[model samples]
Target: MRSRSLVVPAVLAGLLAGSVADPASAHEQVSTPSAAVVGAAPASRVTAGWTLVARYGFDGGRPTPIADESGKGHTLRLVTRNGGTVSAVRHGIGHALRFPGKCLTGRRCPHAALQSPSAPNLNPGTRPISYGAKVLLSPSQTSKGQNVVQKGYSATSSQYKLQVDGAAGRASCVLVGARPGIKLITSTVSVADGTWHTVECRRTARALTVLVDGAVRGNRAIQPGLSVANDRPLSIGGKGAYSDNDQFQGTLDDVWVRVG
Candidate 1:
């Protein structure tokens, strides 16, 4: 409802012409693991061995009381702050949810996100886990960083997160384990090209990998013994209704999480 009056800039039609992603943060202690571009794998093959913990096709416009298609019963609750809004948008053969971009220059920007109640099944402690979404973002929507999906908090507890960072909008996967270290991997390419792209974050015992359209874009070595488990809700589209949240400003569909 609130988004009906919002007008997007026409400049979004053109993709990033000559944008280079910023280097990873020095405090994050980023690492580069061997990247293996295994080519695009079919949908069926992508989840061949993993168990689907939660999945949201966002069909029918992501109506309230959002259902989790995985049948694992991880229903998502919508959260809004300030004047944040969520609206329906056309995507491929079905529909998706579109979120507001940055807040007006000095205005208290809107904030909206979807969160799931704490569930043990969603916590894949010490296990290989993968999560991702089909996203459509424009250069104008890029921000310092916007969370796509995450469980737990990096500062207070272990966490597994996927987010698009910097003006380049290069996706990244993060792993904060039981120890006092963070494992992060950022994509070598940007996805803020005003097109649909599948971005996934895969965490294994060996390393943390980021995949764009099923090809490895970046990888970072991680401790094999690390574990992630917490009572925090699984958040999507941003961190929640909090102020200065990492709100995502784009369309999202077919979000899913799997573990082995």
Candidate 2:
């Protein structure tokens, strides 16, 4: 059985691993948490059967620990680069993180993201997995591609990512097997119309599917044995606080991950 003492220490470890020691060199910092913690994230029927690994509502605003709603202790820490910033703002009646859009040409672009430490449970291995976020983006913010969330890098290892691609603001799901090359399927409908939209990506033994607003928008076949596993953190908003990191410029709420 899990004890409070054990849980407390594990949570502390997660905090330390996420904290930014030096913003100048590291370009990020975890904010000091508040005394009162928010309640667990609202349950999702979409994750009814699968095990929820992590969930963030961004409820407490900036500088507070981005609590993992799943209660699995995979809290997220904020990261920023250049002049980037992330703020906790009210979205409809709930809370969300607002990120700055891309900067003009030749200008230093600020970048921001949320990340969790590499943990065994976060790696789905050969199991099916699903991840998604409630996003609000504008057509003007669209670019070649702006990553919403991802784990692993295809150039180095297997990866699973959801990104909005092209000026059309089309959302797409991507997966890279242990082998070379990328496997992607894009949504037929664009979600970059300045309205709140729920976008999700699911990877099964047979295929990869992207869903928008609870409706299937794209699907692609895949090898039944294709697998995804890596020692990389789960990233949101962008890959990291680095230059040209496929930064997402918009608001994000209820970001979550489930594996089975």
Give lDDT per model, in order. Answer: 0.75, 0.73
RMSD of 1: 8.7
**TM-score computed on alpha carbons, candidate 1:** 0.83
Instruction: Report the C-alpha lDDT of model 1 over 35-62, residue by residue, as the tens digit.
Output: 6534444223445689999998767523
TM-score of 2: 0.81
Model 2, span 1-260: residue lDDT tens: 11111111112233333433211232111221221211233223554699999887766533445668798988777666665767666775556777767687523787777788888888888888999999999988888778898888777767888888889998888887776557787777899999999998888888787788887776777787788888888888887776667788988888889997
Segments of candidate 2 deviating more than 4 angstroms? 1-47
Worst ten in a row by lDDT for model 1 = 13-22
